[model samples]
Target chain A: MTTMVLSGNEACVEGALRSGVRFFAGYPITPSSEIAEEMARRLPALGGKFIQMEDELASMAAVVGASLAGLKAMTATSGPGFSLMQENIGMAVMLEAPCVVVNVQRAGPSTGWATWPAQGDVMAARWGTHGDHPAIVLTPWSVKESFELTVRAVNLAERLRTPVILLSDAIIGRLREKVDLPPSVPVVDRPRPAMAPDHYRPYAGGPDGVPPMADFGTGYRWYATTTTHNERGYPVGVDAAAAEGLLKRLHSKIHDHQDEVVLTEGRWLEDSEVVVVAYGSVARSALAAVKQARSRGLKAGLLRLVTLWPFPSQLISQVAQRIRGLLVAEMNMGQMVEKVREASCGASEVWSVARFNGQYLMPEQILDKLEEVRRAWR
Target chain B: MALMRNRDMVERYFRRGALPTTWCPGCGLGTATGAMVRAIDQLGLDADKVVIVTGIGCSGQVYTLLNFDGFHGTHGRALAAATGIKFANPELTVIAPMGDGDCAAIGGNHFIQAARRNMDITAIIMANQAYGMTGGQYSPLTPMGSFTSTSPYGHIEPPFDMCALAIAAGATYVARGTVYHTQELVRLIARGIAHRGFSVIEVLAPCPVQFGRRNAMATPVDMFRQLQRATVSVREAELHPEAIGGRAVRGVLREVEGPEFTAEYEALIRRAKGDTHG
Candidate 1:
């Protein structure tokens, strides 16, 4: 392993290159600009293409187009840009175009803070696009994990034939850390059609529920549309059964393969009374607080979620049933906390230690909340 | 013999069982699309080497009717998607078919930027004056004082001069042809596709049911007659400016050589790889 000091955004770019991403179309947005800048410098050297698109929507559309044309592609943005990206991202979902979208989240309902950290886009990552679609969202807490999860994000996108979100915050995006990078990592390319172009159906999946994708100009002459489409990739207007089947398959393809898609890190969960569930940068502080609490004999544990969407429900339910209280810590105003509560099913007392003041939820704030919850439990 | 040859061309270029399109009776989109197909056939480009990227509009359905790889994407983003396709695989010919609203309103930024970049893509803006799919809403291409669904009072804003916009935005090739002039439209589209840089072929198609009904020209023939009477060849317009009056000039308005984006990017890649010759 080679040791290098890099920011989270730079690490993400490195990871994308390592994952065989050859095309990057992005607009410069705060906290995410470093990713685009690094890509612009690095891609051409590797014979890859990098384009600075006009806006987030165009960036996303370009990524989808590149993906369809047989190149692994990516784009990065912040909150306001992320909002602009939703429509095309929905098109990506409908078309099942495999690409990675990295939102280095900043504070915003709309352009709130360009340079500060906030995990306010958790829900947006899942349902920002207007549809009942499946989403794969990965949250990275550290610079090293940013690299690791970006690789995972691209791999999952290709494997599932879906767009994946690498949700990093401004703090994690800009945080510099010394990381020991591996020489090579496992890479997964999208499944290619085994059937001849004459008989190939674009949306007809094998057992995996992900159809083999054919690149444009590959003699498949396939059709892809943003409308609800049949297995042949043609729009099935007013065919309720076909639409339902398509929607279900789009969803079940991710949910059925949950074990492969979801990743988490747990610390001191055995014999713990209170568990702090957190993700992204807040998870770093939560881990530290859990360790500090353990040192003080407080029986605090941590569940650091690496996969946020398809929301690790079974695991959360199991943990909730075993724990006395669950404290959800995040840099947003009680977004994932609601998901936690829903997943817990009232099996444990759920409390939220939330903040959205363009600041990180500190270790002390989480520990204090843990203590308060523990006091109430006693 | 001509009918048999046309049938063969249609069979080779269009998808079987996809016809009887959802277009209104006498809609000029079909004629424009037919001209485009004829242009492609005349160029003798391989079907596998072409991809049609369509935006959300009636014109966007052109790709579905043709037997080629297609990307039917969201509203106003066809050019953006085509840009990506061309960058990813420069071997493929990218064509985008968009409506007036799709090209000038929501997708206006992408259109200008693509042209400015001199990307190798053919953009066919089917200017039907209003949004036909959504029941004739006023669009940026709707003429000033034209009646539309939203313009119960006459539309107050002047329509965009799209050919001028394309030229100013650095399009290497720009042309205008109406559906009434099918042969000229085919020639313009063919030439636009042959151009190596960004090309814009704005086909003035008529939405007889929506746009034409609101105006005096209610029938398809009426609209076609109006188009034929109201447009003149660019050469004719230049020679007899007084006789041309307010008629739209129909021909290649601008064609110039410029550096194509994908080739430039390839050279950039070579330079980045330390190739001195690049």
Candidate 2:
């Protein structure tokens, strides 16, 4: 194992490669383009493949296709590019293909701040792709964390047999940190269809809701489609029964064992009246603010949420019973704040320190909000 | 009697009960579909190893009409899906078949990208020159000054020279032919599928119902007759350059060497793993 300091972008490449990613397809988009550029340089050296797709749509599709062919595949993009990837993302989800998408989230409904850091896509990463389906989102707060979470993203994708989104805001994506680079990391590849060639069914799940996959030219009679279908992968023609079954399988596949899937960290909860909940880069600033408030004898604690989706609601609700005043700090106007609010019981006072002006949430900005909540109690 | 159902692969793999298509009598899609299936069978590619992706239109129904792994993608997205399928497994014989409107209009961006990437697949554009699926709207490839439901006063846009566009965009193998030229069409299609790089076959299949009425070619037979008179062999096509330029050229128009998107991409991936980036 070689311990070296690596930028978040470089670390992401390291993580993906270690996690068995053999195919990467992406177009150069600001902030996120480095991921592609590095992949363009590194994948080939590692005996992997990288493609500069014509655009984000094709980039995303190529990865999906590669993953189906039994390669660990991924693509990276920023805000505008991610928007272009929505339709194909839905297709990946519909087909339940195992792949990872690294969204080095930037600001805007359009090309707002191309190179600037913003955590605005926190919510979009979970819901950007149209249609109702299960979403797995992981948020990394630092360069080291970026390396770790990217591997987790691929593992979750294969474990869940679904498209996993590694939502790294531009701050974490561009920041540099030290990571332990092992010669190899444990990567969980999907189970190939162990069934014989003739009886192979494409969408048949093996009790745990994950259908064993088979690559093309592997002598398996495989079927895959974006349309609603049954175990055989043929379109079931929008029948109410078929829709219900499809939705049920999609829902159960993720929800049945939410415990293993959902993870959150608890901080300073045993003795505190005021609390702050944050994720991504904002969580870093919020941590500094929490320590400052503690020095001021303000009785404040910070809950650094590393996993952004499957929203730590129950644990949040449990934490709510102890803290009275809470502040949620995030880059967006109030994206994840709303989730924190919904999860917190009315016993606590919850307020958001929001930023939608294409900027990060400064420690002072969040500290100011904490002061307001404390003074109001007076 | 369907030309398509007669093909060996199409005959063996077709959903037996799904046959007897709704195509108008003498519809050219049947002929082109026949050529495509013959090409597939002649190569002896495995059904699962070849995925046929089709966009919304009469041609999309060909998904069910053949036995290979098929995807009936949204209108104009056949090439995009085929891009994914082919790149996913460079071994898969992926094909994107769509009508003129589906390929040259709604899906124009994807079409150009696929060609430019030379993404190791065959794109067969069934250029009937009209939006035959929804209504008789004029398509981008519809001959300029031609009549249609949307162009009752005749079309105002120049038809796309699909083969030329493909050649310029970077497809290594580019050809154009019509259903009337079945023998040549089949051979060309087979060659295109067997091509190691991206290939575009602009098939001038006729849409009898929608286009026949608009252009005063009342029957599929009339459409075929027009093709026979308007088209010339790729060899003879050079002799009558002016005549062929105004009509169809039934043969390979471009076959050049270039980097294939998949091989280059694979090479890049291997290089990125620390090999080299050329």
Candidate 3:
């Protein structure tokens, strides 16, 4: 009943365990390696399993395989390895197999900075894999949230019967913070089809956008493919009908349930003129920036995203209409700023401050950007 | 031929029904498949407790024919997927089968790593020496000078010796055979399945329309006979690898190991938990 202080990395593994993640297969990469190491040590005695795969592709592929075999599975990797995993991530989505992936982002393009903090993967996690498909990504700014979000990632994966990505980064991954857990938390179980084999077609949708899953040995006969598919999970050739069907499901599955997927922590946002929009470490710095702005007699609020994908576009649009000038602070060359700009449109002047080197956005850096935007507007 | 599971008490439960596969005339996937079925049977693993995983290529379709659990994943990742499945439920017997191209070329990294770590599973590599499903492209295991769609002028790269790689990479059990020699192949597969660590049975299947057309064995049967002739048993392989040309080291090459990855990982968890409280 006693709560222990844990690092963000430690919380990730704890979250996975609490969520009933019995299988973790991954290859050790910088920033993300701690999650894999922790999982490797913990899964076995829990009546689970851990594997250090050959590479990121294999690590990603293994978790998807385990998910299909009726186990909650996960893998962790940083930016470079995450890129390698995109190919298989697409397959998991197409097959509608539920699995969790932890992407503890590092500096990128190549293995830019192996042991440094950077949030360059925010946009890459969105459109990294080929083709038009939907993704669920969560962000955790501290150790407690890392654990909580990792559990939520697994739950979302089961609820949606699709891959749910926990978007973490080097700063949050390595940062030591006090972690607290709820007295009680429920893990979402993946929905299993109750119909007999004859009545089963794996891809048939339930009332929710998710389809019921039938594990490999459960006497269910269903086809799963990356190609456009019909209700039976059989491949439909890529044509007008096929493309339309595939896109419709992809969009509807996530869009219709955006409220469940997108999460943001609103702090001092309701009555502020300028709102600092950020996620991950940028949000941490923005907190400091907002404090500095308020100390300087400026009305600055912080809107921190806990979920990156599904973008929380409606929320951004709503805030954009009220806020005077929005400041987007990030660690990439304007990756997340695009989302803010798109959502804000002409309602607010979207100001972006970003960097690509393996470094967190400093508090002063964000404050400077906010001042520049405010002066230009004034 | 459909299985007579009832007569043999084989508990006919591979999948929903029998297969009328779509392989070409005189293809050896059927024989390899039969060998797998018999191996699983011979092991007497609970049919309900088996999971067969496959990746893209001709062999990917094999999962559909089996009654046990099956995961047909993306190209070149059957082993990767099987590792995950094994970790999820260490009680289940997981098997991975992939074509030469799927395992060696596209999935080469996973294969070597799986063997190196020696995860508990049976991997049957159906080495037809060409990419069969994608209409005959050059594969990693395809012998140099073998003609394929991509290698019309003759494959320029040397072929990978799959069995040699498996043995070197620390597979607890390793064997080489061919569809040409079904009885021996099935026996090796069964032994591999029962070996309790990473086991690899490389089946030298004939790709008649693709590989055999240029590696140009006189016939599919003759191609198999070559396996019968080319291989030396483990004893002989240890003695004189050169005598049999050394490509087909056709018996158990190695069978010693530490505890497998999953069990060790589990033990670690037990230790971690014990330290926590009790």
Best by DockQ: 1
| Model 3 stretches astray by more than 4 angstroms | A1-3, A216-230, A233-247, B1-19, B42-44, B214-278
Q: Which segments of candidate 2 are over 4 A away from where they belong?
A: A182-184, A345-347, B1-11, B15-27, B71-77, B84-88, B146-154, B214-219, B239-245, B259-278
| Interface Cα RMSD, each model | 0.6, 2.7, 2.7
lDDT of each: 0.93, 0.80, 0.80
lDDT string for model 3 (A1-378, tens) is: 448888788899998898888878788888888888887666666767777777888888888878887889888888888899999999898888888888888777787888887788877788888888898889888888898888889898888888988888888888887666776567899889888877886776766667888876655745555546677654454557766776677668877888788899988888889999889877889999999998997889999989999888888899999989888888888888888889988898788888777777899998998788778877
Question: How do all models score by TM-score?
Answer: 0.99, 0.91, 0.89
- Candidate 2: C-alpha RMSD to true structure equals 3.1
Residue pairs clashing, model 3:
A44-B266, B13-B67, B14-B66, B14-B67, B15-B66, B15-B67
- Top-lDDT candidate index: 1
Grade the docking of candidate 3.
Answer: acceptable
How well does model 1 score by local distance difference test?
A: 0.93
TM-score of chain A of each: 0.98, 0.96, 0.96
DockQ of all candidates, in order? 0.89, 0.45, 0.44
lDDT (tens digit, per residue) of candidate 1 on A11-99: 99999999999999999999899899999999999999999999999999999999999999999999999999999999989999999
User: Each model's fnat?
Assistant: 0.84, 0.39, 0.56
Candidate 1 lDDT at A224 equals 85
